[model samples]
Structures are given as C-alpha cells and as structure tokens.
Target: MKPEFENTPLVKAGKRFEIEIDGHFAFIDYREMGHQIALVHTETDPELAGTGAATAVVEKTLAYIEENGKKLLPFCPYVFAYIKKHPDWKRIVDERFEGYNKL
Candidate 1:
C-alpha cells in the first residue's frame, strides 16, 4: 500500500510553492518574468525521497499558474519532464521556450 501523507498543505511562500514533510520542505522554485513564470528548480528533502512530495508540489504549482492565466518557462529538468509526461500542461508553456521540450 502507498504511504499516506498527512494533510500537508501546499503553500505559496514568496517565489516558491512548498509543502512541509517531516520537518523539511519539498518545493518548486519559480520567478515571475513579465507574463511568464519560470520554473527554475524542484527540491525535496532526502528524508522525503520516494514519497510523492515532489510531484505533489509540481502539480500544485502548475494548477496555480494555470488558474492565474500565466505562461510557463520550464527551465528545470524535472519540470520539463513532468510537463512532457502530461501534455495538457503544454498549453501554458511559453512559445519561445517550447523548444526546450525537444531537447
């Protein structure tokens, strides 16, 4: 059975969306550049490895970006991979940066 995470709420703390797990944070760091939000990195505590914390944080960040009608620049490899696996998110990607997907 999958381990059930506590109701760890995702928080938009300044430039990142984060979730607290086992006293550490799992987060996706981002920066707003004009009309685009650049997803720069994702990090999870070593203790939270193998858990779904990273995925959860990414999902939440994507949803937040979508809801705000913002474009995306997925500069982070993990964010790029996640959006590649989930094509629906491609709609929000900035056209200039879409070339990154081909790399």
Candidate 2:
C-alpha cells in the first residue's frame, strides 16, 4: 500500500525556510552569495516522509527568492529536481550553473 501526504505553507526564518507538519518541521537551509541564494540542504521529519512538506518549503523559498530579485544556486539535489519539474522557476536560476540542469 501507498501512503498519503499533504502540502503545507513554509515560513522563512533567518537563513532557513520551514514547514510544520504532523508536529514536526521540514526545512531547507540556505546561504546568501552575492546576488544568489545557495540552497544547501533540505530535510523533513521522518513522520513527514512521503509528504509534500519539502516541496512546499522549496516552492515558498523559490517564490521568496524571486520576489526579492534574487537568483538560485541549487546546490541541493531536491531543489534542483524541483526546479527541473517546474520550469517556470528556471528564470531565477543562476546561469553560471546551468550545467546542473543537465544532471
């Protein structure tokens, strides 16, 4: 059998963006590099596994970056994949690392 998951909004706090689900927090860590935001990592509570919390956090993070006129340096694989799946967000991706999209 398969499990079900839910999508929740993410909150930005300092250098990380987080989403709370099932009493646990799913978060993405990042670092600012000049005109870009380097997405360093993404993690979710085990209880939230298979849930869409990570995606929600990433979506919000991307929106925040774009809204603030910042580009994305998707060092995290999950963030890279999310951007690949949603090409509309590609506009915020750093062109210097365009090679990553091929991976």
Most TM-score-accurate candidate: 1
The positional error of residue 80 in candidate 2, measured at the CA in angstroms, is 0.5
lDDT of 2 by residue, 1-103 (tens): 1122234556777888887766898899999988889999999888877767777778878888999999889989999888887888889888887555563
> Candidate 2 — what's its lDDT?
0.80
Question: Which lDDT values do the candidates have, in the order given?
Answer: 0.83, 0.80
Each candidate's TM vs. the true structure? 0.85, 0.82
**Per-residue lDDT of candidate 1, residues 1-103 (tens digit):** 1245445677889988898876888998889988899999999999888788888788878877898999989998998998888888899898889565563
Instruction: Give the Cα RMSD of candidate 2.
Output: 3.8
After superposing candidate 2, which stretches have Cα over 4 Å from the reference?
Answer: 1-9, 98-103
Backbone collisions counted per model: 0, 0
